[model samples]
Target: MLIRINQDAHPIAPSEITPESLYRGRRNFIRAAGLGAAALAVSPAFAAAKLGAIQKSPLSSTEAPTALKSVISYNNFYEFGTGKEDPARNAGRFKTRPWTVRVDGLCAKPRTFAIDDLLKLAPLEERIYRMRCVEGWSMVIPWNGFPLASLLKQVEPLGSAKFVEFVTAADRATMPGLALPVLDWPYTEGLRIDEAMHPLTILALGLYGEELLAQNGAPLRLVVPWKYGFKGAKSLVSIRLTDKQPATAWNIAAPNEYGFYSNVNPEVDHPRWSQASERRIGEFTKRKTLPFNGYADHVARLYAGMDLRKFY
Candidate 1:
């Protein structure tokens, strides 16, 4: 069932959107710095390159998007580093091109798709989604990509495929944080077959109308806005359809703290933080955290008859 949320009731005006020229100008300034990847990684002036034609999606949220600077600079890509700003400061040399995603396991048409081929597979759309972190912070980001279902359908899962596992790229050379004994290397995430095929779940390629920066999971990433940001695995390398629930990075690292289904539930607080309210990025005040990050009406049915507190 395709469920459309009401968040898009107030569509953003064209004038409110950031201009592409501004991003190009920022890229030019970074080029002039001549500091190469190091400069690009640390400089707040660095911006993503422009993408080809894109179509606006009706699934977008009406909330004002967080500034591009904050969206790129303040990140949680632990493959680069643990600090919130570490991704932006350390992912300067990370490579994303020539990337390919392998889709296999319990599927009839298992095949590896190059990043270029994936881009051409479907028409890209802009989806402004509300991202909620387990740390109690949030951001409304304009993500550019196509529905994950669009790609999953191409492989055609078998009846035995009950879950989907996502494996991220873990390059020791480019990702320095791999040296540290953090959660685990090659971050992994998963979703039930129904959730995987949800219309709102997208495979993001870029943000703010530009190709994604290395710090932002360039080339490809999963974006499930209803769940905590950690559920959106970055720099994905493989997608496997499995009969058993695959172990995820966080859930494996701390099962008590991070559940397999990390849906946004205001009633269920994080072990270290409260999930009832959240501080939106760039805002001084906190707002009530909506169930499923304000997508309850569209996604609540997926969890019907299940105890969120227990399953969460």
Candidate 2:
């Protein structure tokens, strides 16, 4: 049975969706796991039952929810593997349970919260958000979790804290992708203090009414709807509040290509590709990309007076 939740905040035009990308993206993983199409629709019923139990923020989208299969299989977690399908096949080796997030740096009280404790830190709500990739592809996803601010507030940041750095869990023994010199190991990402505390930014725990898959950044991950997908670091282990603008994995690797802010801007296209348009997963045709991934009215104020093209 399919479950539908009431979302009354974000309005978007009805969009065409397909389960093909989700399935096709993970075809190799499915074949290796001895699973077939039947497994694509699987999600824990308990997770569905837990939905809306927490205080919800009336955040919703009119666009239909992408198929759960596509949402899970079509991923860009380089930790598991670089390919879209790599995580599904190799991420199973990642151990997510007994995870702990170390909150340190310019904070009043440095503390570590276990995965279980972190879930209890705030009310978990389901947010339907539009995710646009830097590669010019996009997907509308329903992410389940609380805002990043919820966790940040618990640790109590000092006044000097300027940037929040997120460090992903990197274990060479389990992560095969680390062998390749893709970006620096133990991927790092950062957000301005205000952006980290933004209402739209969340630390997602699950999606489509189930726990996160290792390939999809199980245990914990950031969700910055207004920025490119890479800005949302996956499988995070450390969240350090600092005074300086922390260098991100992508930005450090390719300063010219990936910027620290990485906000979704059409005017400033990627060096190699056009950012004016994006291909929605499952669709053959491309659609005009929106500034700040269509959250401009709400989030544009965050960058008032500053030049996005320069930071981007």
Candidate 3:
């Protein structure tokens, strides 16, 4: 049986590989381990119960953790820069101290918000979720934060507000990737207002009971588990309530590759690879992909009477 990670024959010695190298884009480590297609449906919790002493629930009986922080501090928050770990390392340079969120468009509370002010209003709760990327790697991340719907409710979405758009900070000097036209920079992503209000959708502030690491989209980020990773924008700078569906970064670039609604469907294949299976981190094993990333029970109703195949 394979005991260590990495497929390269001349792999660097373990002492030479730093902690940072253990993770790059969150789930890259999944590939290093032979997380094969053998055990597809089992989650980490099952394995833990059978093995070591189970960790006591850090939360109240009323609350359960999302998933363990499967991947460490890694993100694609381009505002801090590119490279998997760049955001976590460079995000501190961003002034989160007096951060402001520019709120405009179709909302009653059209105003600017001090970052601290927003954090203070919500009753924070931790949700342990299995975050799966479209790239076929997965991680069980225990994301700590409050329900995002609570924030949207505060904005008092207008009747005409059909969608929500997020724009990240755009100082090209600090964010070298801004010069690339591959994507309209400052990186913008959005969700239908209905999807924005979904309980699973999160405007996350912290993780693992600590303030968010800069690379993990410090200050604020969006988390939508059922969809692919990109749906969750990081280091949010502005929020706009729109009357029509906003042009999203991934969908705009390749409509065929990414759909407006990026739900996790094992049957749907990305342009580059099949989504029928995924490699879950920590487990060092492969797992089957669920219809909606295993949140189908919670979110299936949202898409009732609709065809996921066509939208995905």
Candidate 4:
């Protein structure tokens, strides 16, 4: 399942990687600032726990990971709020434990898995992936989880199943933004069955060596490195396999701007903006956006004869 990288082609300088000490220090700083305490007030549900025995995946990108601070602080979790800083600032009291994810529809062994049960489904892997947003921003994230195909296999998708749908949690009490009619409530996303089975698609449980924070889709979330960041649904509540393409939140909200495939294609520009280049969160200058966010070699075949501009 490994996608071999040509080190010479994508050279990662030693200075580029964020120091582990610095990553830990940032979390400590957050705790000292009372954000950690706020989370503890609701319960230890959002408390960060270090994932044990994480296996490093060969499918990982060698690029330096974005700073933990920026990764957590700047996000697009609209359930919490519309502003970039809103999720981090507002999700402190959100509870994530005692969560369950139901996997059903067109499956032989449809079942609901507790958060703890899903964690034990497969050995966790640390995959450093480059995540690109349709808005021309990108980040390298060290995501900890297993390939989503492992979970799908357990449910035993039927022959009739051709797509996978993800439903995200939308607690009105905790997620203030849910009150706003921005898109549909209980955010949903979907992928073609083959895309769901891709090795590059993972069900992320944690990031940066620790369990995810509430703002960053704690408990469980989808991570498709070859696709735009919005394709990665957060705080997942259910995963359904079906024969038809499921309705996705963004595609429903604005079909002209968001496509169902949502692959990172630089050639197909967003209606209001060009997608040829992107600004890395901490970088000064914009870098040329690569096809499939630079994972084209590993995933382009999935689309073979289809026109990307048309499908996109």
User: Whole-model lDDT, candidate 4?
Assistant: 0.91
lDDT of 2: 0.84
Q: Give the Cα lDDT of each candidate.
A: 0.90, 0.84, 0.70, 0.91
* Candidate 1 lDDT trough over 10 residues, lowest sum: 38-47
Highest lDDT model number: 4
| TM-score per candidate, chains pooled | 0.87, 0.83, 0.75, 0.87
The collision pairs in model 1 are none
CA RMSD for every model?
7.9, 9.5, 12.2, 7.8
Candidate 4 — which residues are off by over 4 angstroms?
1-46
The clash count for each model shown is 0, 1, 11, 0
Name the lDDT of candidate 3.
0.70
Better structure of 1 and 3 per lDDT = 1
lDDT, model 1:
0.90
**Tens-digit lDDT track of model 3 for 225-252:** 8888888887788989998888888888
lDDT of each residue in 239-312, candidate 2, tens digit only: 99999999899999999999999999999999998999998886768999999999998799999999888999
1 against 2, candidate with superior TM-score: 1
Ranking by lDDT: 4, 1, 2, 3
Model 3 regions more than 4 Å off: 1-70, 79-82, 89-92
Per-residue lDDT tens digits for candidate 1, residues 214-298, read 7888779999999999999999999999999999999999999899999999999888878999999988889999999999988
